[model samples]
Target: MKLKLKPAIARRPRAMMGKLASAVRSKIEMEKIRRRGGPARIRKGPPEALLGLRRFVANPRQFGGFVSGPALAATITREIDPAAGPVLELGPGTGVFTRALLARGVPEHNLILVEADPMLAARLRLAFPQALVLACKAGSATPEMLGGLRPAAVVSGLPLLNFPGREVERILAAAFSFCTADAAIYQFTYGPKCPVREEIMARMELSAQRTARVWRNVPPASVYRITRD
Candidate 1:
């Protein structure tokens, strides 16, 4: 099915494609510089940070600031197995967590990035051409979106507390549907508790436990892995 975003958020016209092209070229150049053992110049903001900041400006209701740090991103994704079918990432933002998943041995083709912000989705497609990029709200997700592919693990960078309880439940239900019986949902939250509330987890027949805490983050964050058991 074709995914659509609110027209106001996807303000990118054909003219904006040029901006995407420039960003892609800059990313490639940075990679090449790293490979050559030369230091690349720093940008005002990292791609993921910039994407998050931009999206937040567009709609703070949809996004919190990007993942506080790359370490946090890598930490949340630590337990996922490479062979666990395709990995479905919720609110991948600018691919920060996506990059960590790839570095952890998850293949590019195994990734399915769901980004609500249309501009970020467009940028994600240009940045990670091999992965599936869907521009739709995570709460609107359906099992049909997976096309028979089951997920080994679902990693989320979504800020659930900013959303209503019902919306949170819907997003969790959708993510868990595509998971194997043993699959897990790894989610991070800035708040003290699990990102998805306990009652919602109970309603979905899922359980969660705190896995790690990133104390160095600005507001600190914790990771939780939800399971069917």
Candidate 2:
């Protein structure tokens, strides 16, 4: 008797075509941005332009609060205890801190990233498929968003002062709720003082102490280790 052969399984042409198109678009966009010196050009003459300029002036590597420098990211990551259970990185932008955390031996699976910008979030997801990436406001991160994942440390790249006082407090409160009692929260600011003011700190029942000043960074930056009382 002659042996029978099974028919080959066909792949979805549309799906495959869509993926190929996306890859091509991403590569083209990266090349364009690279030639322009960065990703995402700033829109000038708008009211937000001033604020964006100030942020950029403070940290040029971040491209107007879109990301943080690798050195700054490494320093912030180093502040967290190596034995910490997991790390929650807020506003991970272009995955600067995410890369730093991974370099410091934080498992990709152990990292949870909260990013607001859709473009940046998509890039981060592609860069770190193992990470739990959520595209949402930090303040709106519910327990479900966390998917039962608890973090041992919270590292923030959020422009706290740029946000409304109540909004900032809400985000910080939500972040703290997901952290352990002794969990450390590392934040950096270009301002002369800590970004979280006394009132907010008191309201959150948290205390912040400056850990290091990195003058080598553009406009200089200070790192604060915030913890619950």
Candidate 3:
């Protein structure tokens, strides 16, 4: 006797199996790198893309469907001054922006990366051994995490639109707490406007300006520069 399966159910297993195969391949590649290694050299393309996609499927609200492209990363970090001070990066998924920051002359040790995903956080540590990687949510960021260094600017990759207003306020408030007087927080959103709402900005005495729109991004995104009013 054979059991019949619905199309939806049959399709789910195939998708899961495909993801599993991808995970297996990623693991094999990691193992190869580990064996051949001095420092763990995880290359910067397909593996990270696969991991980002898996995390996106698991939690769309927290992880967007695609990683930030190089153009998007470069655009967002364009205004950042590497000589100013420490750079606080939230949701540094696949460290695309982190790499861009480095390219812009920000030293590895001057970066403080806050990533919520454990797997991604571990990879970040491996990928950037000199930079500080904290595996915690954006709202949980604090001065203590910075270890006495204030951030000159914040380059956030968080999906703030998916969060509630209060949480958004909290995250921004925390971000500003340890920042310099001239600091600005740079955020990108797939939406038509700023991801951080107006009320939250007003309440915090913060102001936002749309800096750039990158059509090259996967879904096309707008960059915003927010600073204290």
Best by TM-score: 3
* Per-residue lDDT value at 35 in model 1: 98
TM-score of each: 0.78, 0.72, 0.84
State model 3's lDDT. 0.89
By lDDT, highest first, what's the ranking?
Answer: 3, 1, 2
The C-alpha lDDT values of all candidates are: 0.82, 0.78, 0.89
Cα deviation in Å at residue 66, candidate 2?
4.1
lDDT preference between candidates 2 and 3, better one = 3
Off by over 4 Å in 3: 1-39
Q: Between prediction 1 and prediction 3, which has the larger TM-score? A: 3
lDDT of 2 at 126: 70
Q: How much lDDT does candidate 2 score?
A: 0.78
Kindly list the per-residue Cα lDDT of model 2 for residues 86-107, writing each as its tens digit: 8999887666677788888889
Root-mean-square deviation of every model = 13.0, 14.8, 6.8
* Candidate 2: stretches off by over 4 Å: 1-67
Candidate 3, residues 167-206: lDDT per residue as tens digits? 8988998889989999999999999988887777778998
lDDT of 1 by residue, 53-72 (tens): 77788888788747458779
